[model samples]
Target: MVSCVALLGGSYDPVHAGHVALAALFADLLQPDQLRIVPAGDPWQKAPLQADAADRVAMLALAFEAARLPIVIDRQEIERHGPSYTIDTLKNVRATLGPGASLVFLMGADQLMQLDSWRDWHALFDYAHLGVAARPGYSLAAASLPPAVAAEITVRQGSLEQLRTTPSGRIYLAETLAVDISATQIRAALRDDDQASLAACSLIPPVVLDYIQQHHLYKN
Candidate 1:
């Protein structure tokens, strides 16, 4: 069987339950030889990150500590200054793992909707297969995606097995993810200490929540 490595990348400003769930879901399905969590250094598209890189990495460590899959916190993007781009990261990983290794880069459906806007988005397929997780209200249908992105995913969509066997250029859509959580909302709740909203959602991991409070994060 071909060796596979699954990568989950995000700002992970405070690593919440949804991030863990998305990673866990793919880990269960792909069962890749290795799982890596990539925290973005500077996400050009988003606002300035609330948590610093060290804090974000610390939170990721705590969040995925209990996960069943072996996890590696990849700091390539964080180490490289300037805007973090997926295509660049993918290229670096592909070079390190070599051509024979099957690499699947995971993302949420919301990211898929804006796929066309990423730098050299089309070249992403040249480096690794995409494993996108769908949440409530996010559709994988072509009509929901940008015309260019839809065209690519439409013809490249494949089963989990095929994604595992293929080296690159495949798309796997996993709709099993039902939790729809966002980092922006989590940050807002933390900033306000809105316990009621946080409790109602129950999407932030206790350990992560504790870490955030202990470090006095997002209290601006």
Candidate 2:
């Protein structure tokens, strides 16, 4: 059997339950040899992160330490300088896994819609297969996809079997548990200490919450 590695990259300013749940779901679905949870070092497309790189990585480690899942907190993107681009990260991960290993790039449905805007977005398929998780109100079959992306989807889309076996060039849509949580909301709640907001932050793990409180993160 070919070894498969799934890469799920994000700012992970403070890894929350939604992130952990999605990672677990994907791991079960793909049965990859490893599921790497990557923290973005410097995301150019978005506003600057509230927490520092070390802090984000530390929280990620705490969040996944007892996940009972085959997950690893990958710090390559966190360690690298400058903006963190998906294509660049994929290239490095692909090379590390070699040509024989199947590399799966995991993303949410919303990210798929905006993929064309990413730097060298088209080249992403050349390095790894896309494993997109369905999000609320986002339809993978919608007509909003870019022509090139839609074309690639039509041709390269595959079943879980193909996704597990093929080394690259496939798009797999997975229905994962929608936790309806966002890091932005969590940060806002932590900063404001609003009762309602704090309640909504239940999606965050206890250990991670403790770490956040200990470090006084998001309390600007």
Judging by lDDT against the true structure, name the best candidate. Answer: 1
lDDT by residue for model 2 (1-220), tens: 3398888899887788878877888888888888888899899988899999888888888888875657777788888888999889888888877887888998888888888899998788889999988877777774767777788788888998887888888998876556567788888889886688889667789998999999989999
Question: What tens digits encode model 1's per-residue C-alpha lDDT throughout 93-167?
Answer: 889888988899999999999998999999999999999999888898889889999889878988889878778
The alpha-carbon deviation from the true structure for residue 102 of candidate 2, after best TM-score superposition, in angstroms, is: 0.6
RMSD to the hidden true structure, all candidates: 1.5, 1.6
Pairs that clash in candidate 2: none
In model 2, the runs with Cα more than 4 Å from the true position are none
Report lDDT per candidate.
Answer: 0.88, 0.84
Candidate 1 structure lDDT: 0.88
TM-score of 1: 0.95
TM-score: model 2 vs. ground truth = 0.94
